[model samples]
Target: MTASDDPVLTEVTGRTGRLTLNRPRALNALTHPMVRRIAETLDAWEHDPAVRTVVLTGAGARGLCAGGDIRAVHDDIRAGGGAASAAFWRDEYRLNARIARYPKPYVAFMDGIVMGGGVGVSAHGTVRIVTERTRLAMPETGIGFVPDVGGTHLLALAPGELGTYLALTGQPVGAGDALRCGLADHFVPAGRLPDLLTALAGRDVHDVLADFVGEAPPGRLDAHRAWIDHAFAADTVEEIVDRLLGSGRPAAQEAAAALLAASPTSLKVTLAALRGAPGLGPLEAVLEQEYRVSCAALSAPDLAEGIRAQVIDKDRTPRWSPASLAEVTDDDVARFFAPPAGRPLRLATGAAPQEVPW
Candidate 1:
């Protein structure tokens, strides 16, 4: 119940520690500083003998986190400085890896708009709590970026070709869909979250979740699973778009519209990454592919134009470099996944590589 003075409030009650992301004005959109703070606090709590568990949540009613502060990333690009942005990504990725394999019990209250970076922070937790208000996504493609923060790993694990669909289109999944898709572990009422946290602080993590049994609200994604799988299974984004347009299914058509409106380069790279990311289980491999694609994306014309149209100009009219997916060459997509000249993608394991299921 104790609160710190930081933008991200860190508090401890008995053996439990809580970290609250506080930036409701922008839906708690994360900045580089916030990422550093969260990582620092987590590192601190990891070694603290008194803290048996850690809980992460956001302040206010709107949501947990919308995503990263793209406006800042855009500005960094505009300044013609790559090191700063690259460094931010390096640190953020490290934090994400730490969270994914944290030693202690880590719980995430994934309420509201948990997208992109929010997903990175919360989805990897031992206990992921979703509510009716939860609307989760890995929507980096919509903003002219590939999903980072170990997003590729989760995308690789999504059912069937649904990962490609969601990654390419940046679709939002509600609470039930999130649970069914393995993004969340438990579903509790939005109003009951505070009480649940209190209960968790007073008891063991598993027991706390076990005691709060409530009927999960119905999900929206399951009904459209077949459509999502079929439409997104196309080999190319253009083909996928065409199928979606031709399917006559309302959901697929809507998804197509969203994809068409997004940055063409982002859509292309995202689809390619999800397709090629399978069988890569280590978090470092996933992050490396994403980092390669991201660094290449910064130099592409579509990224700047996308940010200009969406965030800067607020015009919602972007002129993509290739203009259409058909124009995007296989070489262009390949360049993103290809290792750089000297800096190859490396995994961060100590004495021995961690054994993963797949």
Candidate 2:
């Protein structure tokens, strides 16, 4: 797509390569074209001596990004079957890996509702900045999906069972909680974002960031860390639910309610994915596994059901196939990890010789 038509706005300002998620109307929800554009721009900027750093942000005030265009994915699933949806995940995950491994100073101005695909793009960068308005989450499970975009890798690295708690509950967190969870590196006020970008033109990015960094307000996650660990420490989801129910604490009760409301298959697969993530060799491995789950999920109908209930019909009630946690067996979860019948995601291990196609 041309610059005017593109959802992502890319430009070079002095020594910095800047990208703005331009789809403000859609809350900067990423499409395949947008993802490819970002990957290509980053690739081009990586080798350019003139570009010392990269700055990413979203347009308008809603926040950096909401996530991928799930409505579009829903349409793709309905019309073109799984091919289009699979292709999007494959490309999107590849871009996520690229961001995580980018060598230069990559700064993300995560000031709004950063979730799912937003987290995929920004959280993996070298310097992740969250503002007071920042609300972040890896909330794919709510949509009958496991958190992809190397989310499992980041979740695995979170303190103790917090990753399990966040992944299963799909809870949105603020700047302080984001920092406490290792989701963000610094907290900058939303009003100062323009100054941060302006400073990036001539000054060192670190100096600019340090100058603009503000103390984040207190977060509740640390206070409940013990409860979170105790409730989510179980080897299985059922056990975790049992623990939560037995805890009698308000936080445990809330978490249990959230988990119970999520898709059964998504909960099972997400639990297994996060549990097995630490042992996975690399980010690419996690992406590969997630790709398998996403592709397999296309056939399960929960994805479509989720979109219908949550986004399309606005019913707020999803009729999951397994229906209950007991119905989601080991075999059901295992199938999600199996290799796709078509092609597996082949992530770039090093610098690429050719531009990644859309």
Candidate 3:
């Protein structure tokens, strides 16, 4: 790979197959090539007797990963690579499914900001580690995209209507909240990471984690759970927003504003995805539905406009089509959920051994 297309660093260290996302400059934002490389490495190591576990981390101090490189998707749209973007999503989603179902133990070191596609890479692993500095979210609606990466599946399982609140608002939560919400399994300080990595080399995954797992910082989500569940229990985004507005609390009012600021179509479709996720059978099924939404997004003006406003122009102002929630019809949401005309997500089967399915 060239400098622009740098491969994610992969190596076999002792009994561990280690994968480090090396693109610190862009927050290790995943590329299609990077996704393919990771999947290939995992496939090779799955059956290797010497490699009993896999450890995934990022190279920088700032964060583990931010998300997918959507700036490239913006360029693709400008260059009319609608088909290319679709292919990229297809492969990325398949890799996500693979990681979730890997035969061996998988651990993720989510040290910092982990969002969108970052969650896709780490959250499905058998063990997910977060630091005090970690800030996690699936902030897709801000950019006119629905939560993909099996996010809807995981978010759907969060206690009460917390999933709907997160899906619509795209709020960042800290390590404590991450653990409280089931996004992370362990908490380790950033300073202790090196020692933790060293421990992984000589000990079992569970044993090492048990030794290093410290007291998780307190999370406010539990305190706010009642309000969140009450405000977000409505069937639609509009009703949720109305409920928040009526609550008269500053936090509730702020949440209402956040929901209003997001792309209408994204908000509507994401809510639909979250509500529908619980009924979806498995990670593969969630990914299949997400593939349809992602492919459908290529033709939607909001995805391109959202990217241009957020990434290309570096402006926070996005002019979403169907600018208001009321303008987003049920039909508009249904179009996104519908399967596309071309080939669907190709999920591999029968080649891997039995283990705990993520």
Candidate 4:
């Protein structure tokens, strides 16, 4: 591919090694090759004494990344049982884990529409910066998939039931909410980012951030926490919906509607994933579990159908197989927890967290 065609653009400026996701037309959505490229670059940069920091951003004005190229994944699923898609996720999740524990600073420009795989890449980094334009989400359920890319680990770590709330609804949150949820570290103005980028190329992040970090305007989630913590705290998705519907608040009712609109099986499985994530140990263990869940989802009917309805067909109506939360039985959700038939993603492998010297 030519320069314009390269999905991931890499360059070095002063002490910063930069990665720019280049698919502007597709909102810089990631492909398997793009995932591999990012992993390869990080591996090279970690040992390069000249590269003091690594920065990731997108080339487009639309977003940092919309997500992994799910349309490609959807097509792969339809063609041959999602073997390629599974392989893509293995590497993607590995990169997510690597980002989380990188020896050197990993700064992500979490500006504009960042979702799904977008969250995987940026949210895991050491220095995650969000601007007013940031629209961040883990919208896996809407596509009949569970949160992968170590998403459950990040969301599960969110205060109270905020993670459960975000994972179930797949709603986008702004800079304030992202910071509140521990998904991002700093908020900077969009206009100021150009100058900030200039300073970051050669200067220390702490000194550079001291000049640019400022208050994020208020977000809506903090206001609704009382009800969210209570309603989503329920043990089951059924009870969660019933509590929301019965809560008698408009936002709660709207959340109920959002949950009702998603694939029934996805909602159930997502709840199980969220509930199970807390005990799954480090990000790596949670990622390994997410891999099993994601691979299981590949063979399920809704993965492809959800993508077709929401993306390809643009009909906004997916006819989910289970049809309702009530129809998704315990066994159906349990199937996702079972060990995958293929090779598993085994990061960290039950080892204690390492203290990286960087």
Q: How high is each candidate's TM-score?
A: 0.93, 0.96, 0.95, 0.97
lDDT of each: 0.81, 0.88, 0.86, 0.90
- Which candidate number has the best lDDT? 4
Residue 229 of model 2 has an lDDT of 95
Ranking by lDDT: 4, 2, 3, 1
TM-score, cand. 2: 0.96
Worst 10 residues of 3 by lDDT: 349-358
Which ten contiguous residues of candidate 1 have the minimum total lDDT?
349-358
**lDDT of predicted model 3:** 0.86
Tens digits of per-residue lDDT for model 2 on 1-358? 6776569898988888999999999899999999999989998998999998999999888989999999988888898886888998888888888888888889999998999999999998999999899999988888898888888889889988888899999999999999988989999889898988989988778777778999998887988888899888888889889999888898889899998999999999999999898897778778888889889988877898898889998999999888999999999999999888887765545543222344
Compare the candidates by TM-score and give the number of the best one: 4
Which is better, 3 or 4, measured by TM-score? Answer: 4
lDDT, candidate 4, 38-125, per-residue tens = 9899989988999989999998788899999989989999998999999998889888888888888889999999999999999988
* 99: Cα error in model 4, Å: 0.6
lDDT accuracy of residue 220 in candidate 3 = 73
Q: Deviation in angstroms for 191 in model 3?
A: 1.2
Which regions of candidate 4 are displaced past 4 Å? Answer: 349-358
Error of 2 at 282 (Å): 1.7
Off by over 4 Å in 3: 1-5, 346-358
Deviation in angstroms for 154 in model 4?
0.5
What TM-score would candidate 4 get against the native? 0.97
